[model samples]
Target: MPAPKISVIVPAFNHEAYVVDALNSVLGQSLGDLELIVIDDASRDGTWDAIQSIRDPRLRALRHEHNRGAHATLNEGLGLASGDFLAILNSDDAFHPERLARMVAALDSDARLAFSGVDFIDSDSQPAPGHERALDYASACARCAGQPPASWLLTSNLAITTSNFVFPRSLFQRIGGFSELRYTHDWEWALRASTDTPPLWLPEPLVRYRVHPSNTLAEDDVWRHIHENAYIQTLALGGSLDGLDAEGACTALLHNTSLPPLATLCFGIAARRLADDTALRALTRPGPDGWFLRQLAQATGLNDGVFRSARQLADQQSALGAQQCLIDERWATIQQMSGIIAERDAALQAQAELIEERAQAMAHMSAEIAHRDEAITAQGRLLEERFAAMEEMGREIHARDQIVSEQSAVIARLMATPWNRLRRFVTKLRH
Candidate 1:
């Protein structure tokens, strides 16, 4: 089979929940004439299972028995690419369906463009928050008419990720693959590749960049990232100035980032060792001491070490002042919180008093109800006794009526007899 148009390299790790969607995003892209190579970097989770579950003819699955870092894995994937164009998709991130198409068209249009990049989405697959300042900075640089792409990139990184990169395989061969910096590798690569011309910066978001606890930026090696950024800053603004106008780039960088003096910004890379190469180089004549910085330290009756010590002391004093300000703010907050607590306690006390009053009223009502209940019970007993007496009287009346009826019947029978009739006639003649 002929080689695909693009070779998409995915360096996978422990992202079980997200790996499948990432692969699906690649396979389901609008531009389908691309090959996808996923190298599982010895993930402990079910990320391999998720990657394996994808059934596609364009996919080539690979696995690492031991976990190599991201840069190494990417280089390995790069070696296996057969396509003219190359793209990288981080395991936890997804792609816009039309990303490859848009990027390819831009690259085909301009040969001088280092790569093609677009805006990105966050973990929710929407425009990320808290990036307004960075976005504004990049947008402002891009809007500067007649400026070279390198000048636009001198202030801040435009295309933020290797995941955002879509360039020719030949460019990858020239500038090489990712560096060892876990946090700022993408930024370093962005600066290195864009030294001549700017990448195609499409303002529209075409990729989902995942930001979570597991990101390389969230790693514990903060000093390493700082050192890496120091080197990267050196590449852009350090000794050689990386083919940029030194005065203009330095002013813009300082204005944009509010960074320290040129010497400190270039040399004071916060790596673990204080006497590292970069720091020592700052003491050289051409670095911080040459141009505007003469033997002013000796003029002030202090050597270079003493001058450095004085600067350190001043920095400590400033830090202490900041700490004091924070403490004062916290004390004010504590006072405000105390006031709120006092009001809450007062309200609770009022509620307690109201509850006590209600309890007393309820007790009084209960007693009154008991008293009424007792009275009603007594009246009920009296009515029951009266009813019993009336029933006895009715029985006696009934016996008397029966006796009178019997007596009347006997008298009527005597008057109806013949002897009674003759006696009545003799009594009438005598009268």
Candidate 2:
């Protein structure tokens, strides 16, 4: 008998509900030159009995004395694997029928390519809201250009699950086995491997990563998520202060641990110094139900930032109003000049009529003079009333001008305060 070309390793620990589905997915793979190794990490459940139910001769099963975590169990499975290639699949997740076949074909096609796999289901295992089902390779290239192929091996949709995708045994040994990371060791492994040789990516979404309550990435594991994500950012950025620019890196670091209320409070403010809005949003959105980001909002006067942007937008609008006012003032001045010219023309016409009447009505001079005097008196009273109304209107305009000037000054003062200083003050107060 010859050794199998590929060994699919599954580290099982009380995954009775989903482990069988995961195993069956492998057994059904189009590539049959494979061995399935299920190492039960001292599960208290009927995991052992469950393994006994499977009668495949190629299936090799083992048991641990106590519950070793996935990292340890995976390393043990690697030692037991007899094939040239290693595939790691979690007990709760599974592969599509063509996953093993496609991955093997890809690795066989390129010598430099150590591993190859497809996009798996996302964290929800459903299409993201507003996104269509069946995202092709072209769409993926557009989403994350220049990112590693294995990054898309999201644990839900597809993973280099110890079972589905195969990797060269030599490369696995060179990079060292999976670290004893609490939650994010797989991401760390992918990042480390890509530094030397990038994994070959197949654009198909061939892995069905299951989303269930029993999974390790459940929302309740906030501390674990924070710790793992923080460590991962450190590794990804090569320990540079500039490395914090890696999206969601700083906020994950700041909020992951069970810091004192004040310490966590202060760090939340510090997270906002990240000039990237996308990173900021990621930082605020917490693990699982996004509780951490909410906590971040409450801790750091994040509403203040929101208010500031709103106020600035308002000031810009006010400035636009002022510009319009200036245009209106110019228009009013033109109207006043036109009104003066019309009033002068009317007065001249009235004077000409008075002179013609005086010459024509000399015989009835007394009666004509009396009528002309009455007309002049009425015109004088009308002019006096118009002058008084114009004076009152000027006073009202002056009061409104003062109010606008004061409001504009206040806005300018608020805009002058440095945002950085304000954030630092908030952090200090929280600390």
Candidate number achieving the greatest TM-score relative to the actual structure: 1
**Using lDDT as the measure, which candidate wins?**
1
lDDT of 1 by residue, 91-154 (tens): 9888889988888887884533333334445655556545643365456545433454555555
Alpha carbon deviation, residue 120, candidate 1 (Å):
5.3
Model 2, clash count?
A: 14
What is the TM-score (0 to 1) of candidate 2? Answer: 0.50
lDDT of 2 by residue, 1-431 (tens): 78788888999988776678778888888888999999999988887888778889889889989888888898889888888777888887777887877777778744323433344444445543232322432343444344433333221122333343467777677777777666666766765555555456565666665545565755475444543453444344342232134354443233222122332333345454656423533442346765553455567767422222222445567988999999899999989989998999999999999988986787588777889999999999999999999999999899999999998898777756798568768999999
Off by over 4 Å in 2: 109-142, 145-165, 239-431
Report residue 141 deviation for candidate 2 (angstroms): 6.9
Q: How much is 81 displaced in model 2, in angstroms?
A: 0.9
Please list the C-alpha lDDT of all candidates, in the order they appear: 0.70, 0.62
RMSD of each: 14.3, 36.9
